[model samples]
Target: MRSITRFITTSDIVRIALGWSAFGALLLATPLLSPPVPAPLLITALVSIVAVILVCAFGVVRQAEALARRLGDPYGSLVLTLSIVLIEVVLISAVMLGPGEHATIARDSVMAVSMIILNLVIGLALLLGGIRHRGLAHNRTGTSAYLAMLVVLIALAFGLPALIGQDGAYTTAQAIPVVIVTLALYGFFLFRQMGAQADDFTEIDERLTLRAITSTEPDAAAPGIRDVLREHRTEILTRLGLLVVTVIPIVLLSHDMAALLDDGLARLGAPTALAGVLIAAIVFLPESITAIRAALGGEVQRVINLCHGALVSTVGLTIPAVLIIGMPTGQAVILAETLPDLMLLTVTLLLSISTFAAKRVTAMHGAVHLALFAIYTIVLFS
Candidate 1:
């Protein structure tokens, strides 16, 4: 009872209450949305739903962070990345399944998420950390592991399909092997991350920063991952339960938001891909704040995990889920990016590798990433 009381706070109740209220309100409004509606009314409803979804998402991340604090690196960061990606997957699925045809929804969301997290969030993190501490240090071994997996996954998901297919989509036969391979690889990566390679994902102290970054090998000490389940079983269970409860309304409301987004964008004659950007933004905004905060505190490794780790999961998990969904529903999901977008992604990946290769990253690296993001934005809007 005492633990329960400490766990439940006023803000917690309010966030959940607002989530369910929006869910109920919009559930009733779903029918009206099917018909032609006033533009003002349509925009208002969407704004309301987007706002509430973000609130609940913050609550979800809040609980996940609480769990992360107890669990520590690797597992803690894994928990956070998975939670955000789950939101991304759910929103993409909702939009795909909801209203109009959105063949490129999956591709666009993955690309938008990659560009935004990799460039925008990361750029800001590096800039701030650089200014505050002259530069910030990150665990390069773990970052390299993440980037290697990411490079292959991104190439597989975005590049290969465009080269091989007619409309940047796979033949059913090709998709099967791709999905199988992608998940199999991700599963193996997770296995390594959780076991012997856990220390690779953690921060390096100033005294040990050089060896930690340049060793190109795991530490001989082999600091194994903490068995948090054994150590903090009760608190972990409590947070997991709260996380689920907070996530439910966001999941439910995503359908309503999807419908509104499709309708709103169609009305505005907005780019179809803009819906994907918005979905990525909605899911990522809160977590981006956390990443910057970590950067401010000189936790560059955490920022890498949040930003780099997110794109890895975004490509690793989202592509497979999109394929799985597309096959069954006959949605004909498009996984290939356009040539221009492809170029930007390639540059972004290579730049990230250079930025984190050194003992520390400074504003110079961040500025370049931000400039790239600006170019991506111009292409997106123009």
Candidate 2:
């Protein structure tokens, strides 16, 4: 009874109430946002609402991470990835249907996420991890495989569309075949990840090579099996409940947030691409934190899986979703890339090949990636 009581605190109830209150605010404000509220007040209101939504998003990430810890690898990362992707899809769909009818939101946002994860986040992770530990090792086969798939998908989804399609934007007919092939490939990758090659994503520990390492020391105190099970069961249930509760408000509030975001970005005279980049940053925040911690903790393989897996999932799942919705509705799905952006992407992929070419990650490799990331950032803002 005491433990159960501890799980449901007054503070928790108050937070849930506040979340619902925010939802109510969304209902009242979104419909009336037209004619552009006075710039000052509009910006203020938009910033405040975004702040609240980000707080809610952070809560969801915390709970999701807790659930991940309880569940362990592959399943853990899978949960986090799916949750974020759902939010991304919701935001994109809402924006597409908005007054602006954002045709390029999906493409720009997915590209932004891929760049942030592949360059900014991964580069920082490896740079810091390398500086701290000199170098870290991960399963090369898994890392290389992830890089290979990433290159292929990026080319087929982003590159080929520009080369063969109408001004780089795929017509409905062009999109259909691309969607089918991408989905099929993703399905195959998922099976391999969860089944036959599951171990590939983990670190290869040399300690397991010796018989002495497998032998338990007599002086070591062993934990009780039942206690471990009970703890895990309790944690899983509690965190799962929190995850459900937190994610509900995110989905409920995201539509209004998307509407306001478009209004705000346009009002500020921001670049069109900036809108997608900002949205991608908000969505990727949780995973970015997780990847950083993993790298710092010397868990290079987990970092690879999280960063690389996110890019794969973002493209694999997101492009397909966009095409599926856009094609049927006669909505224009713009995926054309500027020549400079395409060049940046090409160089980034090449760096990835070099980074994962070996069994270990080094500071030099990290430095090179970070240099490319710096160039990408400069190009983005300049």
Instruction: Give per-residue CA lDDT, model 2, range 1-382, as digits (tens).
Output: 5655555556556556666788887678766666466777677766766666666666666766665565555656766777677666766776676675767777678778878888888988998899888888888888887888898888887888788878677887888899999999988997898768877876666555454567776444543334544766666666667665765665565545555666776777666566556656666776777787778888888888788988888888878888888887778887877788889899999989888887678778878887887787677766
What would you estimate as the lDDT of candidate 2? Answer: 0.74
Best by lDDT: 1
Tens digits of lDDT, candidate 1, 66-152: 876778777777776777677667777766777789888777778888888989999998898888888887888999998899899
lDDT agreement of model 1 with the native: 0.81
- CA RMSD per model (angstroms): 3.7, 4.3
In model 1, the clashing pairs are: none
Stretches of candidate 2 off by over 4 Å are: 1-20, 31-43, 97-100, 209-238, 248-269
